[model samples]
Each structure stands twice: as structure tokens, then as C-alpha cells.
Target: MAKIPGVRPPDLSELTRAQDRMTFLYLERCVIHRESNAITATDERGTIHIPAASLGALLLGPGTNVSHAAMTLLAESGSTAVWVGERGVRYYAHGRSLARSSRLLQAQAELVTNRSSRLRVAREMYAMRFPGEDTSGLTMQQLRGREGARVRRTYREQAALHGVAWDKRRYDPDDFSSGDPINQALSAATTSMYGVVHAVVVALGCSPGLGFVHTGHVRSFVFDVADLYKAEYAIPCAFEIAAAGYADVAAETRRAMRDRFRDGRILERCSRDIHHLLLPADEPEADDLGPDVVRLWDGGSRTVAGGTSWDGEVDW
Candidate 1:
């Protein structure tokens, strides 16, 4: 079950198929089931069919239940199903990977496994956050300090601009009510960012635990990537949502953050950033290093002139 059973490998033609352009979707109050080629959700009201292929990731929030068949279909369609807590504020578990290739993942592992290369990639990530800045010589500690200072400054600036009282970020995962409005909103915003970043990370065939900066957790890479966007998107959105004085700040913040992610094309940006970080600029292209394949497409048949067709089974 480690690999999707009986699913055909994805090809170039499959990539252009019409599907949901929306990268992430949060849904609740439904029971998901597989119906033929589509996944449908049913509730007390009625049934709503979901085009699983269109989605990058499906956020199963509170009150949602999914069948094993639905999960299978989702995996086959190259969509990830993420189970989350209320308002999609917490990540509980993930279903399956939608990645079609191991090329990028292998590259990420090579970079992460080497101490020197890991440090270089970490610095590269920081440099992207603060464009035009020279972070080449900064140690990990110094990078953390600078990043902390930048985040604090951003919080202060956002609070001042939004006229919201920001004491500090305080939150308890077990007790959400313990945190103030701003902190709660910040948590919600960051969680949303993490979910989206996770989707992109998986889609790009990278291990979530193989983070350049953040470490320890299984989703270390997800945290590392999400932090890149917090200052510009999540932090500001949280402050602004708090300032607006909405009764349901968490929900409103998530809704607004979702809109921001869509407008910012965060998924595409994250994919590009991860690639630039993991793949060295001077590294040769994958095709250049791999076996050459002279492919010929005639009508509906695919012919690899000198190679055998890949069977459905993969080593994983």
C-alpha cells in the first residue's frame, strides 16, 4: 500500500487535463465517497460531486469523513487529502502523495543529507526572503536571530498599521481559547499557509521532513517553506483580520488567507523557490544525466525507440 496500487503512471497528456485550478480546498460537514470516476460528498442536504483531479489538496476539516475508496481515487487522480482540525487550523494527518516522479525528491535528499549543502540551501532560503541581501557568511544561529528580528519588526509594523493591540504571539494547540484574537488569527493564518505549502512540497516530490531550516517534526520542510510567506501574507492578514473586529476571527482569517494565497499564486511560487533551493544552479538537467529516450508519438500510441515501456509496478 506504500505505492498507489493499480494506478497508471502519469504522462504529459494527463498533466494538461481539466481539473480544479484551485490548489487547496477546505470542506466539512460531509461524507466523501467514490462514485465512478469522481468523488462525491454527501450531507444532510444533498450530494456534491468533487472533481478530484482539479484539486491540489483537499482539506478535510471537522465534521468530514472520507471512505477508503475515495482516498484511492484521490491518490489515482493525483490529489492529496489532508485531515485537519476545526477551521483547518491544525494538521492531523495526510493520506497519500500525488507526486509522479522521484527525480526532484532524490535531488532534495542529496542536498539535505550533506551538511555543507544543507547549510547552503538554508542560506539560500533566507536570501530569498530578504532579496538582495548577502547571507552567504551567516551561520544558522545568526540567520535565526535575523529572521526573528525581521518577524518581530513586521508584527510591530502590521499592528501599528492596523491599529490592533499586539502584545505578543501566544498559543496553546490544546487550548485555542487561551490565545488572544491576534494570536489565534496568526495561528489560523499560519496553519493555512502550512497546508498549502505542504501540498506544493508533496506535489513537487519533496519529503516534508527534509527541511533545510526547520527540523525535528515530520513536516519540518512544510514549516520551513511556510515561514517564507508569513511576513508578507499570513502575519499581515492576521493583523488586518484582527483589526477588522470580526466576531469569528479564525474563520475570517482563513477565508481571507485562502483568497490571498490564490491571488499571490503561492503554490507556483513555492514550487519555484523549492526547486531553486534544492537544485544547484550549475547542476546539469535531469535528462542530461539520465538515459536518453527517443520517443515517437503516432496517433494514440507511444513508442520509445530504444526503451521498454514501464510496467504499472514501481519500486517506491
Candidate 2:
């Protein structure tokens, strides 16, 4: 069989960096099943293994019960979990584990605040449009075109906030990746990252049925967090892998994605973005995750004075 592209990797340990300075991610990568504790997964190949426990974030949503075996796994890991569209990148301390109450609270507050802020920006984009006196009975075609116009205007305005050129066609067709084996993998992986993030988020309880910015239709929340983290995590990692050049692009894209799993920044990003969960420890040994986990002064390491307590107001 042709080697399938797009390998998804999971960060084994939590790495939280200085708040706001590092890439923050909300973890979304897993197969969520209903009341099933036993996990059976096959790699790109048909080879299958029955895992002793559930994989990734195991969320037993409302009116659901996790199998005993799954519960045991949850108890042992004390892992934070997502509840199939109920949480929507939200994290809940594993019931079996002694969840760091204080840490989770602060993280959740900050992350929720951050998510809210971004969504607010998207909403503002809609509100700021030319809501002037026009033809009231405009057909769906007219309104659809208007919304597209609004989206472009919003993207440009948002891009300007970062001093970047705002254009709809960020990737040009002329500069397309090489048709060789190496570039193909990178391209596929890059294209797939959004879908992957969306899958995980939906499994973790982001209600596509209810959306703030995206329309609440056809699995809406899948790419929600991906929109927030892909640029920081997947984009750079894929660059490093593709630059090395390989025989097969699709296969390699999968490998590069797996490699990205080990990045500390990805973990930091996930913990930072999802609200209702205390942000993880960005700086090792620090109890509170303060703003600016890591910074550069003249491209040099800079540290802020404080302990591991994310106290007071947060402004990223």
C-alpha cells in the first residue's frame, strides 16, 4: 500500500513557557468513543493493537459512562480531559487525579479570557461592517457576497494589527511546492493540520452545534483551536522537516507532524489557549504562570521577576 501521509503526534509531557511570549496550544488530538474504555488503533498500516487504556483526552460527556478499564487509565494519568463538544477545548481535571485546583483555575480563567478576546475580535468584524440603509430584500447571493467582503476586510484589518500585509490569497499558486516527494508531504501536512485540530476539539467537547464566530453548521468547531495554534506549532515544524528533503512527501508530512509533538511550544500553546483550565507550568519549578514565560532582549534571554502564581489581572 502507498504510504499514507499525515502522522499525528501527541506531546508526552506538559511544557508551559512564559505566558504570552511562548506559543500556547489547547490539546486536540484523540479518538473519542462513547462509553468505550478499550482503544484499538492501527497505524498507517492495518496492524492493530488493543491499548490498555483510552488515548488522548478521554471525555465522558453528559449521560455517558466510561468503561471501567478506561476509568482506571484516567485515574492513573490524572490527565485533564475534554468532553466531546461540551468543553470545546476546555479542560477538566481528571476526576480520579488530585487536580491542581489553583493552577487549573488560573489557566482556565486566562485561556477563556484569551479565547473570548479572539472570538470577540471575529464578532467585531461582523458588527463593524457597513450596516447602512440598503435593499432590505437582498437575496442570499447578495448577503453571501457581503459576508465574504466583510471577512476579507476583517482579515486585512487583523493582519495590519501585526504589521503584516492582509490578503485573502496568502499562499500563491505560482509559488506552489515542488511536485517531488519531499514537498508533497509538507503541503499535505500543512493542509491537514487544521482538520486535525478541529477533530480533537470536537472530540473534546467544543460544540459545533454552538459557535461564536463560525457558523453553527457541519462540524463547525473542528478547526477553532487550529486557527489559533497551527501557525505557531504546525507551520514552523513542517518547515524544518520539509527542508531536509525526503523521497515521499505525504509519508514525510506525517512524520514531521509526529516530530512537532515533542515541541515544548506546542504544549505551552495548548495549555494557554483553552479556558476553564489552569494554564500549565510554563517555567519549570514555577507555581504560577505569569505573563511572558520567555522573552528576547536584543535577541537575548530575558527573565521577569516572580514565582509560579498567575495572580492579578492577565493581559497578553
lDDT of each: 0.79, 0.38
* Best candidate according to TM-score: 1
Q: What is the C-alpha RMSD of each candidate to the true structure, in Å?
A: 7.4, 17.2
**Model 1 per-residue lDDT tens digits across residues 104-191:** 8878889888999999889988997888899999999999999999999999999999999977888999877678899989998998
Model 1 vs. true fold: TM = 0.83
List, residue by residue over 38-94, the lDDT tens digit for candidate 2.
333322344233332223333333344444444444433333233432212122233
lDDT of 2 at 285: 29
Q: Which stretches of candidate 1 lie over 4 Å from their true place?
A: 1-12, 15-20, 282-316
User: Which candidate leads in lDDT?
Assistant: 1
* TM per prediction: 0.83, 0.36
Clash numbers, per candidate: 2, 32
